[model samples]
Target: MAVAAPQTSEGQPPKIKASAASLIDVGSGQIYFQKEGDKRREPASLTKIMTAILAIEKGDLKDVVTVRKRAAAVSMGQDIGLKSGDKLYLEDLLKAALMYSANDSTVAIGEHIAGEHDLFVKMMNDKAKSLGMKNTNFANTNGFHHPNHYTTANDLAILTSYALQNETFAKIVSTEEAVITWLPDEESKSVTENGEEKPLKQRTIHSTNRLLRSDYQGINGVKTGTTPRAGNCLVASAAREGRQLAVVILNSNNRWNDATRLLDYGFKEVRPVVLAEKDELVTELEVREGLEKRVSLVALERLEVYVPRIEVEKIQRKVVLTPAPEAPVKRGDKLGKMKFYLDDKELGAVDLVANQDVDRLSWFKRLFDKS
Candidate 1:
C-alpha cells in the first residue's frame, strides 16, 4: 500500500503523520518545529544511539569482546547471527548496532563495556539524565519492546545532538556502509583456497536509514527504528553549508516523506546570519593613564547563528565593555563581549579584545601634561 504524503501549505508547518516529531538546529539547539514533542513514545532501535555513545566513551574500540550467551539469545529483532564464544572488536559491534540496528550486537557491546547487562541499561538511563533527557527511560541496551522503554522527540533530539559531537559517533552514523570482521567459533571457521584457515569472517552492513541512501542533499545520518509499537521511527540529520539540522520522528505513518518535508521546511525557514565578524572593530574603549587615551576593541571570533527569517530584524546586539582600566593593555587582551539575542533568548556571543597595545604614560610625561 502506498503511504499518504504529509499535508502542507505555504508559510505553515507540514502536517506530518508522526505521533511525535521535532526539528532542531544542531548548532544553536533552536527548535524549528515540533508536534507532540514531549509525548513519550517507544524509541525502538533508536536506543542504539545511546548504546553507541557509551561504547565510544567507555570502551576502547580495539578491545576484543567475546560474545556472551545472552547476546546470542537475542533473536527477537534484527541481528548479525552472533554466537556464544564468537569474538569481535568493539568497533565492529558498534557498526552492527548502529548501522544495521542489530539487537544482538547491542547486547554484546553492553556486556563487554559494562561487564553486566543490567548495569549497562542503568548506565544508559544515567547518561540520559545527564543529558537533560527528562522524559526518557531505557529498559534495555537494544531498543526491544519493553513496557518501560520510552522517549520523547525532544529528548531524542537532545541526545542525538550530544552524540553527534563525538567525532567517532558522527563518523559511524554518517557511514553509508561498512565491513566488519569477527572471529567465528573454531567449528565455524572457514578454510581458504590454499588450505589455510580464514581467521576473520567479514560481513558488510548497510545503514537502515533510507534517506541517507537516497539523493537527498546533505543527508548524513543518523538512525532508523521500527517495531509493532514504535511504528516507523527515525532520527535524521543533514548538513548544508556548515549548518546541521536534526529531525526526530516517532511512530510515523510515513517517516521518510514526513522527515523530508520537515527538513525542507526548516532549511527554508531558518538561515545562518553572521552576527559579528572576526577581528572587526566593534568600538573604542577609554584607557586611563595610557600612552593612548583610547584602545580599539575588535571581535575575537566570528559569531554566526541560525535564526528564523522573520526574526532576523528582531535580533538585538548588546555590547558589554570592561570598566576603564589603567594601561598597559596588550593586543588581544580581553576587553568586552558582544552578545546577540532574539527577544530574550541569547543566540550567540563573542569576546571583544583590544586591537593594539597601550603602554602606561611615563611619570615625566604625566608631570609635563599636568603642567
Candidate 2:
C-alpha cells in the first residue's frame, strides 16, 4: 500500500527544484512534502544502501570474501582499488561501499552474498517489492546506469527508512572516514620476509556525501549519488530533540540545498503529539455472562501522531467495539479497535484488548442470582 502525501494545515509547501523529492518524519512515518516523488529515476550509487543492508542481513560482517575478477570490473564507476584474489571482511567492504561509494565493494558483497551477480540483483528487486517500493528495480548491484535499474524518490525514502532501522547500516552510512586493510598486491606478496607473508595494505577512505563533512547540524547521513543519467541524487536524514527526518532528492542540480530546505520545513511545520499512552484505560466493556460485570480495555501501545500545530486541535480518538464479548475473555484478546484521526483523515489504528481475563459465571451462581 502507498502512503498518502501529507497536506499542510496552512500556507503553501516549500518549493524544490528536484525532478522528484520527498520529506518524511521518521518517528511517525508521515510524509511532510512530496513533488513527483513517485516518478521513477536512476538512483546511481544510492543503490548501494540497499545492497549494504541486504548484505548485513544475509551474512556475518566479519566473514571474509575473496574478490573475483568480475567484481573488480564494475563498469563506469570508481572502485576501492580491490584487485583479483584480494580478501577482506564484509564489514570493511560495507564501509568502502557506503563511505567511498565504491562500486567494486558492492559487487564483491553481492557476489559473496548471493554467489552470482544476477541472483543478487534479483534479491534486490525482491526486497524492494517486499518493502512496498513499487517503482524500483535492480539490474546490477553497484547501480551502474542500466536502463532496467531505476527507483523513485518516494521508493528510495521507503528503502532508507527501512535501512536506517538497522544499527549497522546506519553506522556505516553516517561514518565520515574509515580505514580498511586488504591482502597485499601480487607484487607485494611475491616478496615475503623470512619465508612468511608480509603485512596487508591499508587504505583510508572518505565519505562522498558532503553534508556529513559540512557543519549542517545533526546531518547524520543516508547517501549520495551522481551520474550523467541521474544528475545528482541524495538521501539525507537527521535527528533533533528525539525526532528524526529523512529527505530524498533525485535528478537535481541543487539536491543538497533542496533537501536541507525540505528538512527545515518538516522540522518547523510538523510537531509530534501523543494521542494515547500504552495500557491507558480507554473504556470499560459490559461483559455478557461473565463473573465480572464489566472488563476494562486498554491501548496496546503508545499512539503518537505528527501534525501541524494548527491541526493539533482536530486530532481525535474513537473507540469501536464488537458486540459485547461473551464470558471467558482472555487478557490481550482483541475486543475492539482504537483509531486515531486528524480531522476526517484516519492516521492509524491499534487493537484495544482486555486487560485481564474474565471467566464465565458458574451455573449455580447464575441460578441463585435473580435480578
TM-score of each: 0.79, 0.80
Encode model 1's per-residue lDDT on 300-363: one tens digit a residue: 9988777667668889999999999888999999989999887687888999999999999999
Q: How many residue pairs collide in each prediction?
A: 0, 0
RMSD of each: 4.2, 5.6
Q: Model 2 residue 344 lDDT?
A: 66
The Cα local distance difference test for each model comes to: 0.89, 0.85
lDDT of 2 by residue, 43-128 (tens): 99999989999999999999889999998776557787888888999999999998889989998999999998889999999999
Off by over 4 Å in 2: 1-12, 185-200, 277-302, 310-318, 326-334, 341-346, 350-371
Error of 2 at 236 (Å): 1.0
